[model samples]
Target: MGRPTPDYRRYRCTIGGEVYTVHLNPRHGRRLLDLAIATGSELVWATTWEQYANDWIAPRIGLPSLPVIPLTSDPPSEHGEMFKTPHVAAYAGRRPFVWFDDQVWAEDEEYLRVRQGLADFLLIHVDPMRGLTSRHLGMAHEWLTLTGFSQGS
Candidate 1:
C-alpha cells in the first residue's frame, strides 16, 4: 500500500507587515515518533532557523526534547547548498545517521558524497506540502534492517 498523507493546516504569521504561512502537520509528527520507535533510531533535532524547535515544535509533535545541532556562519553555496550540512556531518562524526528535512537537494547530496568516515547516511527530503509519510518511514526501516541496525540487531 502507498503511504498516507497527513492532515495539515497553514497558519499565517504577520511580522512588521510581512506575512508568512507555516504548515503544521500533527499526523506527520506522530508518524515520525512511530518511525523512531519502529527502527530503533535516534532522532536528533537540527535546524538552521528554528530556535524554538525544542520549546514549540517538539511539544506540538508529541516528541521529547532532543539534542539540537548548533548552526555555524557558513554562507550558502551557488548551487543552493545547505548551511547546516557541515554542522550535521561534524555532529554525526563516524556514526550512521538518517536526516529528514525539506530543504535538501542535489547540492546537498553532492556534499555528502565526498564526506569520508561516515558509516552510513540516509537523507530523506520530505515535501513541505506533504510532510513526512509512511513510505519514508518504511524506507528507513528497510535500510536499518538491511544494515543490521534495527532494534535488537
Candidate 2:
C-alpha cells in the first residue's frame, strides 16, 4: 500500500512541532501597484531571504518579478538589526528611495541619513501581522510630495 499524503491545511514545525498556516491579504496586490503608480516610485524587492520570495511570496502578493537587492551575504542578525541598508544605499547611489519593511530600526534610519547625505530616503515600517495598509501608502505619497520628488523628478 502507498503512504498517505500529508494534509496541506497545516504545517508542523520540525524544530518545535508547532502548527502554522498562512493567511494572505489579496488587497495588498492592488494597493502596492497603486502606491507605486501614485508615488512614481519604481518597485524593487529587498529581502533577507530571496528564494522563497521569488518562488512563492511575490506571486501570491501580485507583485511581478522585480530587481532584487541581494542580502544573502549579510543576513539579518538575531538581534533584529538590518543588513540591507548599506547595500540599498549603495545600489540607489544618491537616488531617492522609500523602503518598506517590517524590520527597519532607528539605527538603520540613522545610518542611511548619514551615508546618503542629501539623498531623499524614507524608511517606512509595516507591521508584519497586519501587512501593508492604505495608511502606509498615504505616508509614502506624502513623503514624496513633501520632498519634491514627484514622478519624473
Q: What is the lDDT of candidate 2?
A: 0.69
Full-model lDDT for every candidate: 0.73, 0.69
Candidate 1 collision pairs: none
> Best TM-score goes to which candidate?
1
lDDT of 2 by residue, 13-128 (tens): 22235343444565566777877787677888787545555555567667787777776576654433477877787778887888889888887777777645645888899876
Candidate 2: segments with Cα more than 4 A from true spot: 1-22, 75-81
Off by over 4 Å in 1: 1-6, 12-20, 78-80, 117-119
Clashes of 2: 0
Every model: Cα RMSD to truth: 3.9, 8.1
